[model samples]
Target: MENNKNIIPEKSGSKYDLLLKIEDIIKKEYSNTEGIVISKDGEMIYEKYFGESNENQKTHIASVTKSILSILIGIAIDKGFMEDENQKVMDFFKEYDFIDKNEIRDKITIKDLLTMTVPYTFEEYMEPLEDFTRSEDWIRYALESIDGNGEKGKFKYSTMSAHLLSAILTKASGMSAKEFANKYLFKPMDMEEINHNDTKEFSFDTLFGEKIEGWANDPMGISAGGFGLKLSTRDMAKIGELYLNNGEYKGKRIVSEEWIDKTLKENQNGYGYMWYLIYNAPIRMYCALGDGGNMICVIPDLNTVIAMTSSFMMNAKDRIGFVAEYILPALSN
Candidate 1:
C-alpha cells in the first residue's frame, strides 16, 4: 500500500523476466513450495506457489513460531507483565508448588529459556506421554523432567526451553500463550491469518499399524514451545518487517527499539532469543528457521525480507541461500 519503489529494486530488464526465472527455480529446486520474497518497505517483490494455497495448503511453520514467541516476549516486557529476561521463572509460577523446592530450577530465569539453555532434557520425558494435555500436571511434569545436563549459559538447542517460556508467560500474564500473543503481537501487526492449534485429540501416523492420538494437545501446552505454530507466508513477512523497522509498524511502537536491537544482535552460538543470527558476508542477518524448510530472513543492510515455505522435503537453508546469493545480487544490480 505504501510507496514500493524505496523497497523493491529498479527493474533492470523486466519484472516478468525475474518472475519467470524464480518460477523455474521453484519448480526445479523445490518439489512443493509457496514462496514469497518481500522488500523491507513492505512490497511483494516475488512470489511463486507450486501448489494451491487453499485451506489444505497450510504448511507447518515449525520453529518460525519461535520468532513470533520472541516478539510476544517483547510485548510482555513492553506492557510490564515481564520485568526483563533475567526475571526468575519461579516467580511467575508462584502458585504452582511443583517447582518450589529445586534450587537449580529456581535459578532458571526467563533469559535462560529464551536462549535455549534451560538445562532440561525433553526427549527423556516426552516419549512416554500418552496424552500431553490430560496429564493434569504440566508444571510438575516439566520441572521433574529437567535433566540438568549442563550448567547455565552453556549453549544447547532444545524445544523444551521454549515450552518452559510458554508456561512462564501463561503464569505471568494470566492467559494462555496464544491468547497473550493474539492480544499483544498478532492484533497489533494485523496478522489475522495466523492461528495456534492445540494438540488435543490430534493424530499422528506411525510406522507400525498403531495410530497415536492426543500426545498432548500441545505437548508444550502452556509449555509447548519450539514448534506448534501455523502461519501464512504473508503474515511471516510482516514479522520480518516489524523487526527491520525496529519493532514499529504503521507509526505505532509495538516493541522497544532497544529490545529489537539487542534481540537481533548475535549472541552465543549466533543465537539471540529464538531467532538465529546469520553473519553472511556483506551483512549480519537475523532469521527464523523452522523444520521442513520454512524460513523468514531479514537482511537489514540490504533492506530485504525473504519469506519461504516448502514441502516436507527439501533443505530450506540452501534454497534461501540461493536467493540471497544469486537472485538478490541480480535484482539489486
Candidate 2:
C-alpha cells in the first residue's frame, strides 16, 4: 500500500520517532497483530500488520462492536427512528410478545440499556451455548434469560443490556443491527470491507478445561450488541475518526454533533452510551475497548487516534497507560 505523504508531518519530532520504536516493539512482542496510529485529523502516522489479513484471519473485536452499536443508536436518534435516550425500550417492541409485561421492563429506557444499568442480573442468564444447534432465538433468550436484580439506573456491566439495545435498534430501523450499521454507519465512512460475525461456530479453551464455542453462538446470535463485530484495522481507525470529528466525514455531517458530544460525555461507569471515558490521566480520552485488546483510543486534546488489534486480548489498561506514559508525552515534547 502506498503511504500518504501529505499526512506525514515535515519535521518528525521525538514523539514520532518514539512511536516508530514502539510499533517495532509491538510487532516483535505480539503475534498476529495489526495496529495503526492516526492523528486526530485522520492521518495515518503509523501502521503495521504482522500476521495476516485473509479470510480466516479476521479479528473477533469482542466488545469493540459496542462502539459501533453506540453510533447506530446515535444515527437512529438523528433519523427520528428513536425519540431520545429516555425513550422507553418497550415502545419499540410493539410486535414482540416475548417481552415481559412487568412495569420494570417497560420502565427500562434506551439510556438504561446503553449504560449497562438495566436493573437486572445478567450473570445467571449469561450461560455459554450448550451446542451449535441451540443458538437460535437470541433476542427472546436474552430477554427471558434475565434474572431480576436491582432497580433501573443502578450500575452493572451486563452483556444482555447491550443485546437489548441491539434488539431495540433493529426494531426501530426495521433491519438487523448489522444491516443498519452497514447502511447508516459503514457505508458513509467508506468502510466496505467490514463483516459482522454473529453466526459462525468455533471453540476456545475455558479456564477449567471446558471447551466453549465462540460466544457468537449465543441464542441472541450475532446481534448481541456488546460484541461480535469484525473489521480491518484501518476501518476501525476510521470509526475513531468519525467520533473524533464529531460525526462528520469529508464535509458530510453524518450525525448531529450534539449527539456525538452526548455520547462521549461521562455517564454511569464513566461510560457514554457504549463508549468509555478516561479522565484519570493528564489528558481526557474516550475509547472503544474490546476483548483481546482491540481498541480505538481517541485523544481529543492531542488531536490523535490510535487503533490496535491483537490475537491475544491482554493488558489494555496497561497499553492505554503506555500511551499516556510514552506516546502522547513524546508527541508534545
**TM-score for each of the candidates:** 0.81, 0.82
Question: Residue 265 in model 2: shift from native, Å?
Answer: 1.7
Model 1, residue 160: distance off in Å is 1.0
Which RMSD values do the candidates have, in order? 5.6, 4.9
Candidate 2 error regions (>4 Å): 1-11, 28-32, 53-58, 94-101, 122-135, 145-149, 193-222, 314-317
Q: Write the per-residue lDDT of candidate 2 for residues 135-241, one digit (tens) a residue.
A: 46656555555445457676766666777788888778887777787788778888773444444443343211123222243444446577656666777788888
Model 2's alpha-carbon lDDT is 0.67
Most lDDT-accurate candidate: 2
Misplaced by over 4 Å in model 1 are: 1-19, 54-58, 95-102, 121-138, 193-198, 205-223, 280-282, 314-317
Clash counts for the predictions, in order: 9, 5
